[model samples]
Target chain A: MAARKPVFNQQVLYDTTPLPDSIPKVKELGATSAPLFSASFFIGTRCKDYNDDYMQCKTENPGKGEFECLKEGRRVTRCARSVIKDLNTSCLEQFRAHWECLDDNNHQLWQCRPAEWNLNRCAFEKLGLEKVIPDQPPQSTPVHLRKKMIFAHYPIPSHAKPFITGQEEAKPKAS
Target chain B: MPQDMPPVGGYEAVQYKRNIPARGFRAGYYLAGAGAIMAYGWYHLIVGLRERNELAREKMWGRIHLIPALQAEEDRDLVRRHLADQAREKALLGENIKVYHSDRYVRPTFAATPGSTTK
Candidate 1:
């Protein structure tokens, strides 16, 4: 009889922060190719700051309802989102390389060390989170026509729009 | 006269014999059968060894590749959950989730942003 091979489990390295209950689960989102690893790296790398801000907010708003402390929560979430976006934009190629390497190698971190290192280096240089930053910094949002600017950058569902002015204008005039 | 008298007194002897020769098989038949069995065994041995080698190779490379890939996948899931939480919070705060830009490093001008001016 042939000898049976022993199975070895590899160590899993990743952020362990629990997302708020309000957020949908990752499996439910059904994303196939999202920049998840890179985003986690960015968030995990700066988790301490986010946690500190949240704690401070909670302390300041003692005895207040959770809703009242939402402002602070928003700040932490905004900072994380900003960092995630920055990683996606700036270190996208490196992120893809690392991710692909892991996938090709069946999620082995050691085999993908080179690609992982590259992604980390790129994220560290591009994220620029070394300085203490606000939740939604002024520079993050443009001053003039900021709403329009944001809408122009991202795709907005038609149902989300408060008005349909273009359709109204295009309608034929009554005789 | 005496001989003829004796033949009439005694019964004639009868002989029993086969019509064809009883040769069983040639030596070459046994040799061919042995050769076929040996060839079959040799073929199985070679194939078995090759399969074993391939399996060993897969095991060796698989150990290196699988760990990082799984970690990467898990990390992505974590990020996805984080983003989902952020989105939910934005909605709860009555903020324009779709129209909010949070990257500070991005240039502030309309032209500096990609896909802003062009369709």
Candidate 2:
């Protein structure tokens, strides 16, 4: 990527043109950031081999990987899409709840563990995909499974503010 | 002129200092207090640093795990464009023309131009 070959911007033309007939076609995955993060572990579970193969291809072909590794790339995409589809069909409620919580919490996994637990349970039961933190000690609870998250900031309490409105009028004056 | 005449023995030797009876602990005690506070702070700092490092590892692995799927998404687009360019050239020229000197692949350095920048 660092090897510079300058193509001046003004003279360059846009190619609205799409893939030719010779190359096989694949649909792009539609899951956005939070949803993707939510489903990522399951994708890793099912598509580990395909994902590794695609990465290996890219690694072996540094500059030309983008063009040369299209086959492996399609496989990775397909595998991820399958995982997402299976989750949607089998664990829709848990999946949506988890991703929504993640979206609300800036996508911090620990903040959304309750929802994640539900999702993980459903995924494991239905799809047999598990979420495991690689290289973590087997004896200790994973960070996600911990009861308390040290850094998470819980929602601010309305502590100082009155809980009931118009109660001042309802009650007789103290004086 | 009686004048203030030293105002009755210079105002009774006006006590210039705060007579608060050595307000704080001794110097050694202060050092001990400061050292204790610092030790406490350093302990928490190290714990926080280790937690942060662990979190960093988690975040890095999260990104690493996602890379393949992300790459696949990106690669599909690249493949489509490459094939599209090939098709476009063939349509215009009626044959696959070799731009490179040899048959070896050379990566394109520029991004695909968009149809309109404003949109």
Candidate 3:
């Protein structure tokens, strides 16, 4: 058979686009869960390799595992499970950190503040996220007038909420 | 013998036409192509089935072999941990030899089995 090029190698090399959001977020935090592995299956079927290009690194110089890198001189390593576990734990830790940060700043509108959004900035040097408190009167209209304005803009029936409530509370028929 | 009977030469020619090998060659080619296609299909089907069987075997052995071998749930949990450890070692560390397997048909003979042996 004539030598055919592989499907993956045919793509353009240097076409730059914005990186994906998930990868950066994952990297920033780190996981904490136990790694669930499908590496052996990959090795048996897809990769057909015992090299460094595999996702995980070997413990010894050359390991016997499917995902282990082939060393220049030594035995091959074989530990797909541990590598997956590490990855999971790291990801979970990262997620937990991000979650905690967000939880701590429950009232903050902006998550990351770099001490820049102000004119009298020297007086307020504490670099923290801004808190957004809702306006009482809103400086736009009174409660009734605002309600009327909203009703004008988006005209749902006044009794629509009550009707939804009734529908939710409605019981099943006997049959 | 005058009008009803055909000439022997014409009858032989009709027989020769009926006995031509072209039909046999076509049938042979058709059967060969069909066989090749069927074999190709069967080869992939077997491979898929084998892969599934291997996965099922791993699951079964994990439950039957590893679980029962351990005493406590903690020990079983340790084995589960070790399975991941083995997986990681296999993947990253290249330590595939987590266990051993023997050939199905091979049987070992002990020396002098209830009878005289020459040693």
Tens digit of per-residue lDDT, candidate 1, span A19-95: 56664333221223334433444454465465455556556655431333444455445555555567668887877
Which regions in candidate 3 have their CA more than 4 angstroms from the true location? Answer: A1-175, B1-25, B64-119
lDDT of 3 by residue, A73-168 (tens): 111122222322332344334323333443454412122121111211211122111111122223432121111222122343344221122222
TM-score of chain B of 2: 0.63
For candidate 3, the per-residue lDDT at A67 reads 21
Per-model C-alpha lDDT, please? Answer: 0.44, 0.74, 0.29
| Model 1 interface CAPRI class | incorrect
* Higher-lDDT candidate of 2 and 3: 2
Interface RMSD of each: 21.0, 4.1, 26.6
* Number of the predicted model whose lDDT against the real structure is largest: 2
lDDT measured at residue A38 in model 3 versus the true structure, 0 to 100:
15
Report the C-alpha displacement of residue A8, candidate 3, in angstroms. 54
lDDT of 2 by residue, A1-175 (tens): 5466453333465555567667787887888988888988888888899989999999898877887898898899889999989999999999999899989988887667667777877787688887766877556556655555557676323232221213423554654
- Candidate 1 segments whose C-alpha is farther than 4 A from its true place: A1-34, A55-65, A100-111, A129-175, B1-119
DockQ, prediction 3 = 0.00
Clashing pairs in 2: none
